[model samples]
Target chain A: MKSAVIVFPGSNCDRDAQVALRQITGQEPAMVWHTESDLPKVDLVVLPGGFSYGDYLRCGAMASHSNVMKAVKDHAEQGGLLLGICNGFQILVESHLLPGAMLTNKKLKFISRNVHLKVENRDTPFSKSITGETIRIPIANHDGCYFADDATLDQLEQNGQVVFRYCDETGAVNDNANVNGSLRNIAGICNDRKNVLGMMPHPERAVDTYHGGTDGAELFKSMVEALA
Target chain B: MKARVHITLKNGVLDPQGKAVHNALKSLGFEGVDDVRQGKYIELQLEDSLPEDQAEEKVKQMCEKLLANTVIENFDIEIA
Candidate 1:
């Protein structure tokens, strides 16, 4: 159940992930900086959200080329579980650990609010504990809209790689609930091996009662139980 | 030598920022604008004394590797 959270220069959510991991897993996770060329052995590696490299060139472009991404990619290649939340998701895609890319929000505005996500699949280690339900998590970003080609999208859907989809509180996927205008309401997806997951929502920001929700706690617990 | 790279979203990809600009142009009374797509232009100064063809190829390699994300972007390289 050991985990490490990657902290880039502009990552604002590293501590949030750290606190959430510690509170949920009952162990202090390592805070790995982006410059480190290697990672200590850990069960999971998290890419937290923030304006890495001040979102220059692209949201996760500069951070993806950082020294630590090599280790992160190696970790995923070894079947180690990797999770990228928000900007972390951007980094994963930029690193090609996951498919697709992010684009500006459909309305050209930064959105910060809680949105319901339907659990599309629970077969992976990250969501094994989650039963069929809609969970609320906070999303805050300007470039959260996910885009991929039609063929790739079809494959993702057919292979069950889509793990999460934006949905209404009633557990129905609809345009009204797709605040970011992501294609097909896709909020998150896993790699072909299902060892890597990238999502725009901030589960770490919703893991405590003080945060007004604990829906994200089960995800961390699921990973720990599956790995440990 | 200088390598200029232009990265643009591929066809069929949505461009919200471009759409916003298009709408703004319409509001500003600009007509005959069929469409708009936003992109990035990067200029790189090479330190090597290579031929234009070789340097262009090198910049193209750079574009494929880092300058552009081939998934949703198309990069055009110009050498000067």
Candidate 2:
């Protein structure tokens, strides 16, 4: 399946994501610059991780207004699959493609570490492979905390839109599940119909055993298989 | 014309930066500081005297599009 990864000024993870996609899909993904104002025809669009605009005015505030984001928003509305990881997630939150907002880590410190994530749903195109089971991916970032109003949080949970829950090595959820102390320990979420996904963790960074594990490889492979 | 956009986190939203500032203020021996909510000060110089309605609309669009994330922060505009 053809995929495209959006590149903004400060996007450091675009290449990492592209490499992961190439390894899994056996094809080089298109690299779309943020200023292009359009997305190439593809099965998936990825907003890779990075400190866009140097994270100057808040994580994604500046990058969200780029010319290409308008097109990205339009593509998502037309049922195109979109994945926003780390700062990409921040862009999605800022663009209103995903609900909730990202806040600085509760400790106000930058956190970089491998995190365990329990897959909550396997029905969507993004998670259809691996039998919809739990997987562990390294989450490395600051400003990864997620927040939303009580009503919004409740609606997300009630609708089964919460896609992944943080977990410990033992596969348990608790404060450890509360990455960055996000309320409800939400690590990743999807839109109402489950097309767009925004999460703080860097799955692309964990796609190889050299990096730690190959669990994340399936995330890209699943999308290719789904699209095919 | 010059305009300043005040972008602040909405009430009930956790402001880690504000909390740090408040702690620092307390450490500095300042009292009577009920609370501290850190916000942004954006100064924009437009090319022309944008009408009130037009400016308001542009500012709002700016906030929604860039200045603020409606999920966590709210913005107010002032044209000068």
Candidate 3:
């Protein structure tokens, strides 16, 4: 499957995402720069993690307005698959492609650790493999708390858009498992159409055994199979 | 013309930075501080030749479009 990864000025995870995509799809994904107005034809578009624009004026705020976002938005509007990880998720929310906004961690600290995540809904393209109840991935970020108004949260829940939630190793969802204090323990969610996904965890960091676990490989494999 | 824009988080949203500042103030022995909320203050110098009202309206558009994220922030514009 063809894929492209957007590279913003301050994106440090672009190469990691490229490597993961290449290993999973057996194709070198196109690296689209932030200033470019066009994107190559591809089956998937990825906005990887990192402090885009140095996280200035709020994380992902400045990068969201770049020329490339216009094309990305248009592509997503046309039902193209889009995956945003970590700061990329912030950019998606900032661009209004996804709902809600990411606020600073409730403890007012930058958290960097591996946490367990439960697959809330596996009906989407991003989580169709492994058949596992939970997966372990690394999450590193300062502003990773997900928040929305009551009505929007209810709508997202009703539509089954809440894709992943913080969970224990035993797959229990509770306050204790919510590492960043995100509302409803939400760690990842898709848009209403289920084509755009935004999540805080760094799946790319967990794609190899050398990284201590390959749980993240399932996500990429799922996408490849779905597109195939 | 100059416009000063104040961007603040909406009420009910948790402000970790503000809470940390509030805790530090208390630790420093400042009494009677009920709460503290931090916000951004931005000053813009307009080179447009529009009228005062028009310029203010333009600035408001700027705030809505980019200065503040309406989803989580509220912005107020003051023209001088």
Q: lDDT by residue for model 2 over A143-190, one digit each (tens)?
A: 988999999999998888888888887778889567698888888999
Clashing residue pairs found in predicted model 1:
none
Candidate order by decreasing lDDT: 3, 1, 2
Q: Clash pairs of candidate 3?
A: none
Model 2, CA-based lDDT: 0.86
Better of 1 and 2 by lDDT: 1
Q: Which candidate do you rate higher for lDDT, 2 or 3?
A: 3
Could you tell me the fnat of model 2? 0.94
Kindly report the fnat of each predicted structure, to 2 decimals. 0.75, 0.94, 0.62
lDDT accuracy of residue A2 in candidate 2: 81
> Candidate 2 at A96: error in angstroms?
1.0
**lDDT at position A202, candidate 3:** 88
Candidate 1, A1-228: lDDT as tens digits: 899999999999999999999999899999999999999999999999999999988889999999999999899999999999999999989988899999999998999999999999898888898755888989999999999999999999999999999999999999999999999999999988888999999989988999999888878888988887
Candidate 2's DockQ: 0.76
**Whole-model lDDT, candidate 1?**
0.92
- Considering the two chains of model 2, state its CAPRI-style docking category: medium
Model 3 TM-score, 2 decimals: 0.98
